[model samples]
Target: MKFASTGLTALLLASVAVPASAETLRWARAGDALTLDPHAQNEGPTHTLNHQIYEPLVLRDEEGTLVPALATDWHVSEDNPNVWVFELREGVTFHDGAEFTADDVVFSLNRAMTEDSDMKELLSSVKEVRAADTYRVEIETEGPNPIMPANLTNMFIMDQEWAEANDAVEVQDYEGGEDTYAASNANGTGAYRLVSREADVRTVLEQNEEYWGADQFPMDVTRIEYTPIQNPATRVAALLSGEVDFIQDVPVQDLGRVSQAQGLEVETAPQNRTIFFGLNVGADDLQTDNIEGENPLANRQVREAMNLAINRDAIRQVVMRDQSIPAGVIAPPFVNGWTEELDQISTDVDRAKALMEEAGYGDGFSIQLDCPNDRYVNDEAICQAAVGMLAQIGITVNLDTKPKAQHFPLITGFTGDETDFYLVGWGVPTFDSAYIFDYLVHSRDEEYGSWNATGYSNPELDAKIEGLASETDLEARNQAIAEIWEVVQDETMYLPLHHQVLNWGMTDNIDVPVDPEDQPKFKRFALN
Candidate 1:
């Protein structure tokens, strides 16, 4: 679907309404957005919050279909196959009343490619971004990129004028623990505007009256009251007591209670996210383990043993409350490179013990398992369960749990490794396997491997992973993808857990679909 092309004056006049009829939506979740700066953190919750206030060149609808946003139309330039052209939407204005133009598009794309931007990995193929005209921009890549548009769905545009005036042109150094004005303030050309922000506490937003698509969408929600409720009981109670109108993270343990409550309903869908365990296999000596001067994870047999020790079925039934699909591969089914052969693994404690004994560790060792309590559904609980399962194989685990804000840094920061074993979740925004290899399996470097805490790197695999970006032939590209997955599976780089199932609890009065990405845009919402 495309945006309405009728003149903006008609759109504004048709959307104007009395304030007395305005509807307010109270939303609660387990964790808050990491920052208001669009390029600061490439996290799910942060992108969800920014989707309301920031306008990207392209966006995904509730069904994960790509749609035009800031750009009305886009296509590869006929004269230059390596260049992509984007035509901007007319009569659009930023939240601060700044005019939207190609300059802002060029600036925002360039800003997102900077060293401090966590979004740099998505634009690694772009060679340059230049404005062709007042409302047209061209992005030149090093090679022909057939799926370039897929990469821009989350590349939000920022107002160059507002950024420079506020000294916020530089993206916030989130991993380095630096804060800037843009971290707390926002200015964009989306359907909503930020009214106030109190980090980790509350953020309020009001509908954009002069929004370009005011009449193009339902725009039923006039105000949004977003709160981060970490406690599962409090989040459910807020919904039951009418303190909040909606919640995205409905705890699996309380799904029955919420659905049985009066005036409430639970909507569910399969999420495109995978939860898994990462081991620091690259280290010569485990930093967080009792086995000194030797890394047990460094042995392939040991890693395979750990994978066998995990009872994915048990975790799915007990820890996830049957709300997750036990997975054998790191990539979800929605991604291009996933296959049944790659998604098949079995649990065998006896085999795991034998592998440990074969690897010269007859007496099992102990290690620390770092996990986030609020990031994934039953994240901490999953680690705790793994601790017990590993104990059956004589391997003791020390579980350390904390909020996501504190746990994410141990993996993403540029500093030295801080985790020996960790529980983490990954979602493929680009819906491709290259996204997985580049960040997780590739060697840690400046451009890629920002999330690879495993310390595992293979030069041959790295070359194959990088080749996917420029490989245009679909047949050959898929072949290479399959080959890479074969190696990744054999190496047992990560212990795959399961694909999460989404459960959204809301009042019956609101009509909205559960997004597989777990991001629900209020502009598409309606009061039934």
Candidate 2:
């Protein structure tokens, strides 16, 4: 009976395996966009492809725990928290068969730090990348970087020799929707090779049989295809119509529709993504350069009032259809080590009203609220809900909604210019609270961090963050992070919102892992 069961298992697996001649797997997404360079964009689609074609020195497991990838093992120097030594796996080859070495790692680090790279901000303190030998590398950071391994997970390594050969040694200064070779062409040491990219239509990748880690999985999948179908309804339609195998970012409104589909399965997981409104505190008033009848938002009382006025619970229920959990901090609870002391601000409208009145705004004034219509799950509707709630508190909000493409450039562009107030979602790639304090709350130094978009800055908090970055002691570091959060919350840099939830729809034949990191990767997925 055991022998018969084994035979049946083998037969089932063989039946699902694609023939060697079937070289392409058709994949689909919301739309065609963004630069092809892995470092060009921090969005989900970019990460999805980056994980496929580029290999990070370190990677995270399904549980969001750190794991070794290109680097076989690593150690921190006893003398300095700033120094990290990594031993590379020998005998690994880039997609072009060029030998992987320490030089390539160093070159990749330098390129990622180049001013042209959008990814440069992510590794501002990486002082230098030096090779100890052909198969070993040492990174000397400006300060203690406990999140080095996690941060490195996003730095996809490129071949130094091949890049130099093609004059692509430098990361191109390409913006989303811009055409560049790095966007169109891919050369890396990952498990797949780019076969063709037909803009919005589809991107095709073939199995890299020569991949050094080929034995890691029973890789019967020979091809992967990516298509962008931005509309949630359309995406679900395609999956149900059998035109695509998998679909992500399923709208909560359509959960019932997709769940009822025959031969399909819906898998849902809580994401670490936080969707919140970013009030441009630095802006003196609305973008129109005039203060409207007692600008309540121009005062701290008004800002806090705005925070208290909205009920996140209701937004989760009505807009998200109970698909999301209310958030208290920027870092989600699942980020593990960081969210132990997570606390939510009070949702007392009475206090909010009193504060607004004390700020000399007995009568509320009008202000424009910008929102990205297509960015996060039910993003626009959430903003609409906030507007309605704020209106009840006597603040009149003029809603201006646009796609992320137009919204981001106008609000949080390189100039530190932002809309009066806008809704934005943040995912801490390092899964650390320091990312919130350093980038968001510090200052938009451009060279340093991301969270400072609101132009929120506190010298004392900055110093604490600086000290924590290099502190080797885990207790001390965690304490420092807690302090930073206290300062951010007390000062109201960003109104804390709930962590997001991801719901993906797929056919029974496809199996995909759900990661709170929110990067939709298909390398490990298989046909059941």
Candidate 3:
């Protein structure tokens, strides 16, 4: 399971070959997958890497259409409204030659609900999972969940036998810094097989010769070499120099340069992610701030002042190079509950200063801002810009920037001492506002709030958010969604920034669509 030190170098050298048929794809991104454990992290790049080796029951196509993957068909049980029945696809085999069956589905779903699993919140409604037969399985939820299928699009299924044999039944404690067998090794019924993996360095995957969908899909790619290039200039240089064939993130500053280069093309798409700032409003006292005896973020006037002080337009134009869409709400435009009225906030530094003074902090205060340098596009630069803008209103900011691997734990409910202020980006995979309310806005608890490092909690809003899961009436569910947003907007629980835009740079011979979720399935790719 461990990668040989010299094997990665040999693989990297072999990856430069350009077959006449485009059989190999050298892919690079800003950050590497945290772990190969399917249930370990809910991160975008991690999911993108795992998708090549593990698959969920259902998946989203290039156009965001839901399609069956491991499961052939699924529906609610006629007799029991709270139970859903899924028909597993037959003739599918794991890379280890084990047959895919209902037991794997049952086990994988239960594993995803374990306490250590980052995917637990997505399956909070599930009461139990039962395998009816070799290829049939049933899931009983706590209540009737109309959109249960939507939740399974990213819940990857792991082979029960493979996990038990390898003693990897427990999900890796990524946040706790505990590495397990699953962290470095993988076994799944995906399109590609893991040939070698050297964390943060290189990972090699070859086509699964016995893949069940070999005949169904074009299977254009025979080999995949993935690299994690953290530096923007280095990433673009690799692509421009033909050291890499494709890169998921094409820096805005180099988009024109890359596009103009011969044999290179840039594909752009509106991402479904929103980047924003989180404040510890629920804390009684701040840990990283100089304010004494009280938390400044707890003051509504102060929070509103911070929100008004931010100029999203400037960040969009200067930092994002006019590639991002300025946003007024945390939820993106694609989500159901988004409205123009809710997304119409304007910047006013004068009003912001007035609010700060009205809150009895005319002299201002100092706090630290934690940000990730490699996670989002210009993530660190964006935080640096915020520091300057907040300084205008007398709020001195000490910015701490690090790689996402080290920076994410500050906000992912890992450390006891969470960051008082931080920058994070979120994407709505389920295409619902309830996803936002459940994780970001809800009160911190064992089941939910794993990502709500802000410490903001309200019992009334928590009940409404939990209700969205079982509310079968579409209108009623949407009403609850709107009510939750109203409170979120009024409280300024998160300082909304802007929606990110995706730019993928690849060789002219490669043809792949930009996925809104930022996950590109290599199996569906075609090379001209």
Best by TM-score: 3
Model 3 residue 463 CA deviation (Å) reads: 0.9
Q: What lDDT score belongs to each candidate, Candidate 1 first? A: 0.87, 0.72, 0.89
**Backbone clashes, each candidate:** 0, 16, 0
- Per-residue accuracy of model 3 over 1-528 as CA lDDT, tens digit each: 012233543454446644333798889988889999999898889999999999999988867778999999999999999999999999999999999999999999999999888888888889999999999999999899888888888899999999999999999989899999999999999999999998988899999999989888778999998888877887787787778889989999999999999999999999989999999888888887888888999999999999999999999899999999998999888788999999887899999999999999889999999999888999999999999999999999999998888888888863435799999999988889878887788887878888998888899889889889899999998888888899999998699999999999999987777898889998888888
Local accuracy of candidate 1 as per-residue lDDT tens digits, 111-201? 9989888788778888999999999999998888777888887789999999999999999988788999999999999989999998777
Of models 1 and 3, which has the larger TM-score? 3
Better of 2 and 3 by TM-score: 3
Backbone clash total, candidate 3: 0
How much RMSD separates candidate 2 from the native structure? 7.7
List candidate 1 stretches off by more than 4 Å.
Answer: 1-22
Q: Write the per-residue lDDT of candidate 2 for residues 1-528, one digit (tens) a residue.
A: 121222422332234433223334455544344556766665555676778888888888778888888999988877777888999989888878889999999988888887656676667778889998999999998887776777777888888887777767767655334456676788888888888886555678888878878777556567887776655666666666666666777789988888898877888998877888776666544553236433345578888888898798888889989998887666777553455456464588998889888988768777778887666888878888888899877888888887665666654353444576778887777777766555567665656544355766667666776665677789888777777777777677577667899887877666668877767555667666
Model 1 residue 345 lDDT? 71
List residue ranges in candidate 3 displaced over 4 A: 1-21, 414-416
lDDT of 3 at 498: 93
